[model samples]
Target: MPEPITQTEYWNGDVGARWAAMQAELDQVFAPLTAALLDGAGLRPGERVLDIGCGCGETALLAAARTGPGGTVTAVDVSRPMLERARARPAGGSPIAWIEADAQTHPFAPEHDVALSRFGVMFFEESRTAFANVRRALRPGGRLVVLCWRALAENAWVHVPRDAVLTVLPEPAPSPPGGPGPFRFADGEALVDLLGQAGFTGAAVAPIDHPVAIGADAEAAARFAATVGPIAGLLREIEDPALRERALAAMRQAMPAERPVRLGAACWLATAVHPG
Candidate 1:
């Protein structure tokens, strides 16, 4: 068998292109969670900010707006396609520097006032080392806020459609324990402990629950579900065309018989401070 791809290659390859193509839709789908992350960040005017895994530039653009013209935004991601898409988009407020590099090991200037990530920060190969690098990028007393999925079971926005798809296809192999994935930080306590161990102070995690509308209708919602996130990743691995269609049908049928398919998304709003 061929060697498994690294996170950098995984994101910069086809997955990155797919995400870039769906950037606008994904932004809309994740708007609420983005708001929660930005709120937790508490970005101030003229405060420099760093955005990790700044996919398609949503959070970074928003952070730039919050920080205004006097501030600067450094948006970093490993995916070149996503970074290109982000760079192409129009931005307002602070100037943005889009850097295509691994945030896990980037040598960021230690002068940022805040660092933030939305649905990011969970894919690092070494969580402790990655967070330690992030901590090193902050100025004294700088804040770090991140949003990560709490658990697969608690996220109806994913599992609901995922269950439907699974009805037609077999479940994919589980990721290795403590491996990088969306739910890598499901255990809030462990995450906080890891943050502390990474040399951050005042580490804490709080639950943030919100309902997300994937689409205006069931069909649309199912399409959106089957095109992004974990379900999308699962579907991509299947080579059988017939099996793929069946799985897509199941996703559509699993949607609630309602106009707007809104589902619960449970995440952890984790925060830490750079002790300088």
Candidate 2:
């Protein structure tokens, strides 16, 4: 039997704090992506939506707006810090519920018309079971749409920090495969397979491009990429302070020296519907 993959403690520890801070600072960068995600989900009036892995409720809040006065939106995440920040968003008169819970195990009410995630749903240790649980939360014909990185080759969220990670850290300090981590769904074929295995039928994977404004300047952007991304965790694992400092320096240099620096992000819109 294989050992089950689990969430990294680093995400909830000091790393999570820095990640939260970075999220707050770059909240604007995520807004347009969230809008695009929900819009693609074909949001409608009086619909009940679930925002899975909804880091800070960005998509959930948008769902609330799309659903108008009579609809409800629920956003869930495992990160308490993320949820706290999400709760602090200025309340609108629409119904939006925020919960801190693991998506893999949380019970769903089977009343939702749609489920969505933006740059979320990529960290499941066991995607088959995790998605099965998500499938259970929806009505017979309920649908799901998510924004996940298409591959490491295409997204700076990986490549930028990866460039710094390889330089700063020694070779082959490899984290375990099948371990609970982000971008696990980066493989388009595998993601579809998992959804099919989870009882979802007729899925489509679509390419999505959005402008990501990393920071106002190169420095803030560098810090943001270094602290909250996949590369940052690897960088943090290094033992030498000198190497760490060098990594940060390289990240700063890697960033373009421009005001309101914009980077194009590539993601996949994986959408599916439940068979009635």
Candidate 3:
């Protein structure tokens, strides 16, 4: 089957390239959330783990460490560019298998003891089907842990830059409520219900708050804001180069002068179990 059209284009094109180039910086920005996700997974030695949306393999490497030499990690993602970067990194003796495939339709063995993701599970066009497939990949009673953004309003790192960009370009229409996107699963009750429908039991979603460091200073942060993620996506739509620079300048003005520009962000640390 073919990949999801929208994501296949975005991730394989500019978005994927930008992420690959900024992998280290992005990883550092989200490091605390990664640590929380790994801690919540409670992985033990000798367990088989599946890391969905494993960009650049950071979480997969961490999982491999927690699972020890006897365990294994299969890291899957849809972007070839991201997977290329992931494969380029040294494994440091950790057992990991990197696969480029969409989690929604990929053929997965029902052999994994745990499945986890960090800010990676949200982009599914059909989340219910995607999560059901994830459940199918796990052994009986295997666990699922995912971290997802809470809401656009709750994530200053995103909304602030996004707003600044809008000052110079047309604002894109908002995604439908509960639709596929970063904040699609923001509501805890909605997520729990969706997981229940996808054959997961004991579903729970917990709120996690953290201050994310976007860059070392306002200028750096503004540059990153204009060149990455949602803000960048918006900027890309503008045909005028001057307008794009205007957006960048607006972002710079909006950002604080303090070093290591930090923004308050919130996400849901969700977990569920496959029934035996």
Candidate 4:
């Protein structure tokens, strides 16, 4: 496995476990983005699909449904714990093959007609190499449709909570500008450049802005902010109980009064074709 050790350790450990536990909540919150990605995939009744970074398998299951019984979907991710959760879900007649492997170097069969991901392609240690590998997994003229964050500044769901936490604790050192993280592909041109370098042709990146559900209520949203995603990771680093509680309170205070608080988020819906 040539994956970055830090990412592997983080996802396969407590973070992954936490995500698995909160899979339902996470899925519901990000349902719109998932829908958008699937909508753009243009899946047919019998087209083979490859789902990268399949998390808890929501996207894979949905893709399977579109592919119908005659088609197949191969869903891959690095987190075994997540894969366990995915496997535990009812299949609902979707033919999905869940594999716990790093997509960057995994020996995928070269048969898929489409490759799809939702916020999954950003974490590759080497974007070009990983995408090249993805391209190789597809038959000629296969399509790639992915959804990735546009920019941290444009995503209130992410930056707002982290900012709240930072009021109580020092901001952690930033990762490399285009490093392996959620915001790695935030720049649309950079993403297009990466795909082009990876042997993909006619790469197009478009903005997909939507309102994402945070929680059923403000309180629940606050709790989610403190217990999941990047803010949660930051909270773990704060050893002082008093400080952590203060940070949590700050985040909680920032949530809106609306039920299922809808926050604006921006992502790039990138599309490309594998050249013949």
**Candidate number with greatest TM-score:** 1
- Per residue, candidate 1 scores C-alpha lDDT tens digits across 224-245 of 9877888888888889999888
lDDT of 3 by residue, 1-276 (tens): 984458767788878888999999988999999998999999999999999999888999889888988999999998889899999987843489999899999989999999999988888888999999999999999999999999889999989888887787777887676556777877889999999999999999999999989989888988787777667767777788887778888998888767889987899999999997
TM-score of each: 0.97, 0.90, 0.95, 0.96
| Clash tally for model 3 | 1
Tell me how candidate 3 scores on lDDT: 0.88
Q: Could you tell me how far off, in angstroms, the CA of residue 14 lies in candidate 2 after the best superposition?
A: 2.3
| Global Cα lDDT for candidate 2 | 0.77
Model 1 worst lDDT run, 10 consecutive residues: 251-260
Q: Sort by TM-score, best first: what order?
A: 1, 4, 3, 2
Candidate 4 at 91: error in angstroms? 1.1
What does candidate 2's lDDT look like per residue over 139-245, in tens digits? Answer: 98999998887666677745775776567666556567655556666678888888999999998788887768878887877777777667766776778898788
Clashes of each: 0, 0, 1, 1
lDDT of 1: 0.92
lDDT, residue 135, candidate 4: 98
* lDDT (0 to 1) per candidate: 0.92, 0.77, 0.88, 0.88
Q: Using alpha carbons, what is the TM-score of model 2?
A: 0.90
